[model samples]
Target chain A: MATESGTSTRFRSQTADFDAETGLAVDAALAGLDALDIPTTQRRPLASRAWAATWPKIGALALFLLLWQLVVWSGWKPSYVLPGPGKALSEFGSRLGTSHFWDALARTLVRAVEGYALAVVIGVVVGVAVSRSTILRTAVGSFITALQTMPSIVWFPLAILLFKLSESAIMFVVVLGAAPSVANGVIYGVDYVPPLLVRVGRSMGASGFSLYRYVVAPAALPSVLAGLKQGWAFAWRSLMAGELLVIVPGHPSVGADLQNSRELLDTVGVMASMITIFVVGVVVDAAFNTADQRMRVRRGLVAEGTSAVRAARGSRGLGVAGGAVDPVGSSGDGTMPPPADPGAGGGDGGHSGGAG
Target chain B: MTAVRSDTAVRIDGVSRFFGSGAARVQALDNVSLDVRSGEFLCLLGASGCGKSTLLGLITGLDAPTTGTVDTTNRRAGMMFQDSALLPWLTAGGNIEVPLRLRGIRRGERRERVERLLAMVRLAGLADKRPHELSGGMRQRVSLARAFAQEADILCMDEPFGALDAMTRDLLHDELERIWRETGVTVIFVTHDVREAVRLGDRIVLLSSRPGRVAEVFDVDIERPRRIDSARVAELATVVTTRLREEVGRHGH
Candidate 1:
């Protein structure tokens, strides 16, 4: 590895003979990465993101379990009222093979998925529509915000009355709760899209539906995905609330099962149910977070070494000095290192070359 | 008055743009008339709030002049901005091929055009790289390629290289000269940088700030690929700077 002085010396030598034009060019070449270094404050990777990626959310679970145990041991609440981890695990084991528990879990999962999928489709479509139109944006934007502000649980009663206590009734409440957040996410994403990007799209002859398909949608994806995540939270909460209030004879949703387990003074069963809900939420959230990070990485938003290296390469092409890097070594891809020197300045910068 | 109509690629006749009405009204441009020539590099040099960009917008049909007619027979006009306004989602090649894609060019033709444009801008291997993947200069190069891909006869650039460092800007000036020579396209470049104006333009047109009006027009008899350090370029830059300073001083700033 080059010493620190060697690196600085190399940079100085590279640009030593540069004219005003070349000096500006070299600076411009490196200008893109002016703010790329991760801030010291953000140097520590967030566990939330890491937990969302790896299947080992077990660490957090262990901490949570310890906290629960502490709460019980410390007599924060009556042991009988707030069951300990051991009681909850025992309760979970007892219900593992039971048909009621399996059916409740399946039913809740299916309804949540249904509500979530529906919300994503409608939310993205309506969101794009509202965001694109001035009148619609002004008129419906506030309404969507208001809907998000209202708790999904509040819609449970109205939805039951409207759909008359069917599966669709519960779904209606879930959809109402989740769709608004998703729509808002998409709307906000589109709203935040840089005006310059939109202008670029227009110059490229993108207009009408093509404009959104090509520019607006992709640009708004991060926000749309965020909305989807939020939508799921809303959907999950709404489904549980709907199931708790609207009773079905054969089908007991997780929420209803929790209530019934409580009615029978089975605190362990209630704890088990709560744990299941928490686990599912965690899993779904992890999935969304993973997908979002992957997308950002693909878009080069992450401050990974690969990007830093490429940035260094760009400077090299402009005849700026870079610290000596292995010309052909193993890259992150586990293959031969990417082309180290594409012969940028020799000529034919006007022709097809892989250097840039 | 009305000298050699054929020399003009753009005709902004008696153009006046006003915002709001009555007491709250502001006249952005008043009775502005100009003729931008065919295949000539013209710089619209002005200060902030001078409506130089507005004039360019009127020429490009992005916005209409409230009280005048901008008539240009050319059906297509290309525009560049200071921000480099590239589509972050699209790869450099994909962004370059956008105009072709919109025009219903076949996939093969689109690829060919994109490749050619990328080559022209010296950004060949960046086909798959998104805007964020490239450095600022590279992004601007991609933007330049995109503008060229429009195949417009006239190119209107509003401080296209403003955000770039001096070295990159100068390098691009050389690249732009090469491109202009290769393709005989008319250019209307707007910039606040007088040295840039002197270096890049065949004709420099100055606009006074606030309710912008044409102040003076100077023909830059400088040769191609004009060196920034060259005596001629420096002399012209100095003269233009003095004129600009005097104009600004009239506003008591």
Candidate 2:
């Protein structure tokens, strides 16, 4: 054995260079470990991944349109009262060229964004308060979840009574509808953080606020994201309901357009406005999904692509895949490594084919 | 309480731990005592319910004994759990940086230390990769690096290689030995496998199950640079295995 260096205050920086013979052995072993690690997937290009994600959604949209056209062909209702897919598309296409249409769309989008932002803030505050205080959790925990299950539209009458038929009226209901889910999400995340992580953090001398900030909070993030996604959906539904009922004369929104089209018996305009609402919901949901998937990838909760649990269990993760490792008795040999699979790295981007 | 030498990294004096109360009382450990010498590799060996991990918990201060004292001289034990519980959000380098950052080390030093630790674990250029991007062995390696990043005098591992396959475990044994030799850190390793204890430890403290107590302590006098499959290691492992089986066999009575 080397001379006993009893104890030191700091960790030494010279493991691989400890002795001439053993140092070389460590290096060779490390080289073999380096070779065994291959890419998680076939490493498809970025365009392929993007295409893979896009094509399925496009196909779904086409199938829906086809079904709508078939329903129109069946003549379930009068042609004037219920327009076909062709008529709705033609109306929608015609509206796209109008500055009036763009203004209404922009106003609706701005309200949605601002209202959702307010809801998130409320949710975070309520969530943190409920999570931090046992009394709050006991008093309001079940109530928060109860509020989530109650239809957001049910809040409109109370919201209008509280704030009148103004922007505040719409925002009040939106916040009420979305904040409960957000708070519950926060509470659930805090409750379920793995105890092992907490122990590891404490063992490393992280305590008090530092433990919560570095360990607990980050561990709770994935759950929090799920909450936020669900919260946004609620806010969207609430905003849509509020817009229809409490439309101010100045604020031209999609919901207000639907109301006007119905009042005027403008069948094409009504179909076009409904289609716009559907598109908005689809787009926002897609954005949330993308955010959730990216976060999951970062945590290794999912593999680089799909099949994370399998990848972890497979030979690529823990086994001797390419070759056996017995380099102990070899003489004067630091084998030049092939770095295992060269193609696993060279391919642009990765196989994030999104289960499309 | 029992007295300890100045060089003793950890001392457990008549430590016993009981869970619940009255008829429900389960004794996890019973008057188990041992001293870990500074910079030595000591293995706590037993079957399940032997309180090997419970003893480790007392040493690390994650738990306290219902009776007796665990004197660690105010030094904490950096523990490695069986599963590589790396924070999913952070990169591999970022996980190592957590302890340093918590200690309020400056940014530049933290970065430098992270690079060094990653390199020490033979995970160079994988600093940006998250836990999922790496394989099972790689995740464990990063976990080991994160443990060292805590800068503790004693590294207490609780079946850290249990999830890994044989080859990966063997690789980590080499990696761990080299790191231990270089750093001179005391290791209070817990494992069920007799061969594993022989492969890595300088000393093995065998404990009995269903109310753990120190059964015997064997000095692993095998020479350095010993392989897991080496004849001397297997021979000692055989002896330890028989003793361990005898202890385990007592439950049938």
Q: Which candidate is the best by lDDT?
A: 2
Model 2 agreement with the true structure over B1-253: per-residue lDDT tens digits: 1233257878889999999999999999999888888788999999999998899888888889999999886555788878887776788999999988987899999999999999888898889987756777888889999988888777899999998888889878888987887778789999998999999888999999989999999999997767999999999999999999999999988
Model 2 TM-score, 2 decimals: 0.85
**Per-prediction interface RMSD in Å:** 15.2, 9.2
Pull out the clashing pairs in model 1. Answer: A24-B167, A24-B168, A25-B167, A25-B168
Instruction: Estimate, for each residue in A1-356, the C-alpha lDDT of model 2 and write its tens digit.
Output: 11244353233444334446676766687677656763344555667666656676677789999998888789998889878889999999999899888898998888888888887888888888888899988998888877877777777778889888999998887787777767766777777677778888887888888988998787777567667766777777777788888889888888899889989999989999988988897777667656655655555444434434445455332211211121111110111111112111211122211111
Best by TM-score: 2
Candidate 2 CA-lDDT value: 0.76
DockQ values per model: 0.18, 0.35
Over the true interface residues, superposed, what is the Cα RMSD of model 2? 9.2
Q: What is the Cα-based TM-score of model 1? A: 0.79
Which tens-of-lDDT digit does each residue in A53-76 have in candidate 1? Answer: 343345657898899899899988
Cα RMSD of all models vs. native, in order, equals: 14.0, 9.7
| CA lDDT of every candidate | 0.71, 0.76
